[model samples]
Target chain A: MAEVRVENVSRSFGAHKALDDVSIAFPDGGFYALLGPSGSGKTTLLRQIAGFDFPDSGRIVIDGKGVERVPVEKRRIGMVFQNYALFPNMSVTDNVAFGLSVRGVSRAEIAGEVQRALDLVQLGGLGERRPHQLSGGQRQRVALARAIVIRPQVLLLDEPLSALDKALRVDMQVELKRIQREVGITTIFVTHDQEEALTMSDRIGILREGRLVQEGSPEEIYDHPVSEFAATFLGDANILRGEATETGIRLGDGTEIATRLNSMVRMTGKVSCAVRPERITILPASAAASTTGNRLAGRVSKRIFAGDSSTYFVERDGQTIKVLVQNAGQIPFDEGQDIVLTWSPESTVLIRT
Target chain B: MTSAQAARKGIRPALPLLAPAYLWLTVAIFLPLSAMAFFSFMTDLPMAGREWSLTLKNYAAFFSTSLYLTLLWSSLRLGLEVTAWCLVIGFPAAYVLAKVLKGRAREAIFLLVILPFWSNGLVRIFSWAMVLREGGILDTALNAVLPFTVSIDLMYSYPAVIIGLVHSYVPYMVLTCYLTLQAIDDSLIEAARSLGASRRQVLRRLILPLAMPGIVAGAVLIFVPVVGSFMEPRILGGRTGTFYGTVIEDQFVAVFNWPLGAALSFILLAVVLLILAASAPILRRAQQ
Candidate 1:
């Protein structure tokens, strides 16, 4: 296992810049996720790390060595493609043994290593079946086993679980995390699903328009997004645009809202504050006189009753403020009912407009 | 209705759609085959001017004659050699066309590969004869480039026959192999490379196995025809061309023994069927 670093990488295809000055340090034994929407260059950076594509101008350092010019076979990096890419001609045993056999390992050694890898993926007795005979999730396990059996310096996964159905995807997510921990290989996975990044990685780097937008722990980026794009993209955040004040911002209706003091964005003439939906509490309008912190009076425009929690859309001065409240057997507020939305200042993040 | 009856009803509509093609095939292929099989059992043609009797002498002659067996063995060998050459020359061309060349260039080259079919097969054989003869284009070109005098006469030989057959049929190999190679996902190749497989290893382990269907399909197409091809051998091989097909032609045309010819043709059909049956399992597995 080794720390992989991308320093000032930029790549372009024709006139389109796929990755621009992107840099991230994936630490040793840490699970890192490159999260982004389509066309955000997340897959580009993964390919660069895997040595499938060279960066136009940058250095990719793996295990304290510069390997920008190294070919994929020489890189000793195992990659699992989005489609799993299991060789259809080979049985499960041969598929897992491919890396070792190609490297000229002995037959006895390959047999043992392939068995061990298959067992690691919890497919111990399924060595004789071909790829078409196996289920989709089983194919994924075979692909993973095939990659890791070579004992690569780092494991690269390009949206490997994206092909699975929802239930299987969640199961594989936990299963994948277990395998990564068991093997302790420094791994980087690319995903567009923010929840997968949040649930799986120790660190997340969100990309936008071929640029790195934010890189930090999932909790850190989630709680304190630096820009409006990051705020809305990573999770649901009610954004309020207004004039900047000493603490937070004043809404266009002249209502003052307090924000966290340690926000990354500097207070300026114009700024926006991102308040998470779950952080706000919805109460009757008559009860607003007793509460403290940032508060707004609005009618509940809509209420969505989920199993564990409920989301209330409150319209205040022509702007809808979303408030999430846990379902605790209390009578839910109806639409068109007057309500007050209140949250602590620490829950609000001041984002650069 | 019962499910079986329902299934029969479901097929009823498609029968109208399928009739014309099946009828054409029965008339064009099966009727002649049936007639030949019947004639192979007779001693002579059943015409008003001749007395004919049902006999197994036609088939008996095929097994009793060592010359016929030798010719059949030689024909099978010819088929094997031509198919091997086509595979050697065609598979790489297919790989380059499918994977290396891009959109417009790939299409243009593919057109060139199949362009041999636009002209007549006889024209193609004659053209190869012109190229391979003693003082033809090949000989002249080699003599012009050489530092010493070389005879360079390859016409009227086994090699010339193999060359003509391979040239006439290589496009089938390339077309079949190209389709299967193109259908292979690019990521599978990338995945193999990432697993530390070199280019040669990828070809041997992944590509060749995955393309078995196309290779088998191409082999069947080229081999079946090349084994039965009397024209190219007659045009190119001269005296060396007397294989099973030429002997069969002699029985019908030169020797005027239609019953023996029918028996020989049926034997050839049986041999071809046996080969196809042997490869059917491999082709089916490859497709899966």
Candidate 2:
């Protein structure tokens, strides 16, 4: 268990830059997730930290020691690839024992360690089966067992749960978090799924075009996004683009939505106000007078029932905003009905575009 | 008849589609093999230039001759030697071609490997003869560099036969191995390395096991063809290069003893089949 610090790391393949001076630090015994879309250099950054790839510029340090010159085998980094990469020719026991055997561990020790690793992943007594004989989730667990059996300082996982179905993925996510907590190993998980990052990571580093855009806890990132990209990528947020004024930002429709001028808007000419769908409350036209705070007169454009919650698409001044209401025995409103939408000022975040 | 009954009475739908393939297989493959098997059991009439009667005398004559047994042993030894040599050289080359080369470079290298096969086998042997003969290219080149006169009669020898067979069959080994190597996922090797395996460990534990199928397949292909080859031993094998294939050729073409030749051919067939059967278990285990 060691802290991994990457400083100004950049990598390029010919003219196409894969990583652009990305830098982030993962503390010891914490789960750090590099979250981004495809081609966003999250995997590249993870590989660089794993010693599989060398940065063109800058340094990667683990526990205050430079690891750039270290070979992947010598780096002692445990990596679980997206494809699992289990040795298909070997049985599960042999696969898990590979790292220990390579390090010249005794046969008796290897047997005990292999069994322990298998049990850690809830796959005890499956050592005799080959990778092809296992299901996707089982194979991934085998891969995890193989990686963690070595007990390296840093555990690198590159989209390990991406191959499983939704239900299995959720189950495995919980299992992975439990294993990490039990072992207390410093783990870096690379993924594109926002929900997985939010659920599993102690700190989520959101990357965009090979750059580290934001790094914070899940709640911090989701509630206080510093940029429009970060806010939109984390989840669905209503972004109202407007030009800043002395009073408040004026919308394109000449309607001025009053807001407390934030430091971000003062520095940047353009600003975007983001509000979560659930934060916005919808009131009937007849009960519009009863609502308080930032209110907008709109008509319900669309209504959808999502089991426990109902979503209303409200249109105001040619802008469509989604409002989510919990199903608590309230009569559902019909589409095209007039309503007043209101939200608290604290829930709205001002972002610079 | 009613329309439905007429339709039912027509020819089977799949028969016409399969007819041409079955006809070709019978004419081109089965008929020749059946003739060869039939001739092995018959007594040859030299006067009539054909077989006279069915008999086991030909097979009996095979075990009775020590000279025939020696030649058969020589053929087996040469085939095994050539196959081993091809595997040693071709496996590494195939590994590089499959894992290292990419795009146009890979295609270019593959083409270079196959280019030699486009030329005739006899032509390649003749070219080797020019290099290996006394006062030939190799001898002349050695004489120029050394003070003593270097004259090695290498054109007709067991080594020459092995060399020729290896050269002829190496491309086949490389191609088969390359296909197998290409099918392996590269991430498996990376995973092995990240798991604390050294370079040698990775190759021995991961690569060699995965590539065993191709290696076995190449060995069988090279060994089978070299054992049955007549032209290489005749052209390159001198006094020491005499093999079972040449003796079988002599019985059929030179001495006009078709019964003895058929018997010798059957012995060769049995030997080859025995080898294949013996190696089948090893091949199956390697693949698994």
lDDT (C-alpha, whole model) for all candidates: 0.93, 0.88
Q: Score residue A182 of candidate 2 by CA lDDT.
A: 94
Q: Rounded to one decimal, what is candidate 1's iRMSD?
A: 1.8
Kindly report which residue stretches of model 2 are placed more than 4 angstroms away from their true locations once superposed: A245-248, A258-265, A286-291, B1-23, B46-54, B135-153
Error of 2 at A300 (Å): 2.0
lDDT accuracy of residue A184 in candidate 1 = 100
Taking chain B only, the TM-score of every model is 0.94, 0.88
The local lDDT score (0 to 100) that residue B107 gets in candidate 2 is 94
Please state the CAPRI-style docking class of candidate 2: medium
Residue lDDT tens for model 2, A175-217: 9999999999999999999999999999999999889999999
Per-candidate TM equals 0.93, 0.93
Candidate 1 chain A, poorest ten consecutive residues by summed lDDT: A262-271
